[model samples]
Target: MIRGCIKTITCGKKLSRNTKHSNTSNTGNSNRHLPVYAKVAYILGLRVSPSHRRMGIGLKLVHRMEAWFRDNGAEYSYMATENDNLASVKLFTDKCGYTKFRTPSILVNPVFAHRLTLSPKVKIIHLTPSQAETIYRRRFATTEFFPRDIDAVLNNKLSIGTFLAVPDSATWQGTDHFLSDPPKSWAILSIWNSKELFTLQVRGASRVKRTLAKTTRVVDKALPFLRLPSFPDFFRPFGFHFMYGIGGEGPEAVKMVKSLCDFAHNVAKERDCGAVVTEVSGQEPLRFGIPHWKMLSCPEDLWCIKRLGEDYSDGSVGDWTKSPPRISIFVDPREV
Candidate 1:
């Protein structure tokens, strides 16, 4: 008998969801067929008490979730976990037949006391919830777990704002920059306020590691020129700016990415945030463009997937047993 349970989101057409995160509303169309964008099932907050461990309860919960997913219109079901979690790895792959598919690089960059000059060719536009949702739907259609209701993300108190970096047009000359010429590309950045969502307590550092952290902070304060890593206070309540739904392409892709990073960093600093973070697939072309701490990030998050059915048009479900050329990654802000 299962004493514990796992929560699952049906991902109805009107529901807003992302990989590892789903915020569902009562659509009253639960019995309707899955919408084109609602073919995914996100498993969230699975837990079993320690006393119930080693009794197959966890596996049973996942099995139940998968069944629920199939009964809905989910063609694929997926979740994210730490790479070092051996127990979850075994349970998902060995027992449940889920395949480990994507490993995206989660990079963290500190919010330093520096402001970047907005590029003359580009302007950052703060988008309203409706505008952000409409633009995101068209721009990130292929991205995995993209929320159908972007308003949920933008309206949340934890969200700072959704911004778009586009060319400074003839009619709209940006305040910081002129419209001498417009850039050929654009990008959207959604910043999530991690401090407001939940508290983070990062522990388990060794003595030497802890000492090094303190030393770096001292050096940063004293020298100010050496530019050592400025580690945030993990013990206290500090804010984090998580940038998500980054989109850009073409020759101007690199420039767009850099501007977006700078924009996010400046916003974080303004809000007294400790760090800025974003995740991208290892194969992302714009990966090198975003600013990040090199040694701090090395793709430690493991993305596992299970195909509930055979439709692969949306690219959320893939043949992970045989390696595909490119893997799709959709990092939901709620999942962060």
Candidate 2:
């Protein structure tokens, strides 16, 4: 019977037929997904039917995948769960050595915030039909993603925000957000004091060749659970927000994170944002590494699935792989 099921459940790009059913005494069909980053860790998207929850099936599934990872040359293992998903988090952090990383607060990444940004440091400047033509030519200067999306954001009359780097005072690095470009969540473009972000930015510039087809399937299935459009624009500014810094950061990078977190909680009065987010892999390796972590829930373990090396700096530095670059905690872009 077990061998028969294996023959029935045909292997495809998204799923693979496994031999777990070889015993046939089991009750439900075994399920497995070869995720987009599987070559790196083979994210275990497993379920053994609803009736199989407590039957030790979940743990067994994890072990099966773990063995597969070791065979496939996975040096490190990683995973993720929502902040409230205590069960999943416990399984990884408490049981497995997988780490965690807190996504930024939902305020800055809201889709409706794309409605129109009116910040004093920046202004919600509208792009006209005339101006768009000129900017279109200049869009492809540094990055390749802007050219097409810029036109769309302008067409939607999307509000744009950017921090004009004050020359000399500090390196020109500011974050900007718009509704249409990137065609997913809000887009963030940051310039730092040094070349760290640039080095870190490209770590995941492309999808993992090994996991692309399967990744597209997961994105299709899990999309229904995401709720990013609920938050609105005109969000109060919070000085507390910080993202990962790749490459390398200031000699006082740790002190900077603590000070920023404190300002956001105590001074800015934003409860949602307790720490900064970082793309530590290439550009800002320590974006999540708050050396002297001072904020509540400031730094946590992140199960970075990519296997860069043991010196991964743990959850303190950016570890990039061929995975999707997701700005966790940001508003869903569906409503935008």
Each candidate: how many clashes?
A: 0, 35
Candidate 1: residue pairs that collide: none
- Cα lDDT tens digits, model 1, 13-80, are 33234321434322212212233354556666567898989999999898887887777666677777
lDDT per residue as tens, model 2, 1-336: 000000011111123346334444221221233212212343534445767666766666776677766665555554544467676667656665565533332212211111221222221122344353333322221221122233333333222211211112232222212211111111122211111111111123234532553454345335634422222112233223332111112354433333332222221222232123332222233344332223323233333233525644433123433434442221111111
The alpha-carbon deviation from the true structure for residue 153 of candidate 2, after best TM-score superposition, in angstroms, is 20
- Alpha-carbon shift of residue 283 in model 1 (angstroms): 1.2
User: For candidate 1, what is the lDDT?
Assistant: 0.66
User: Could you say which candidate leads in TM-score?
Assistant: 1
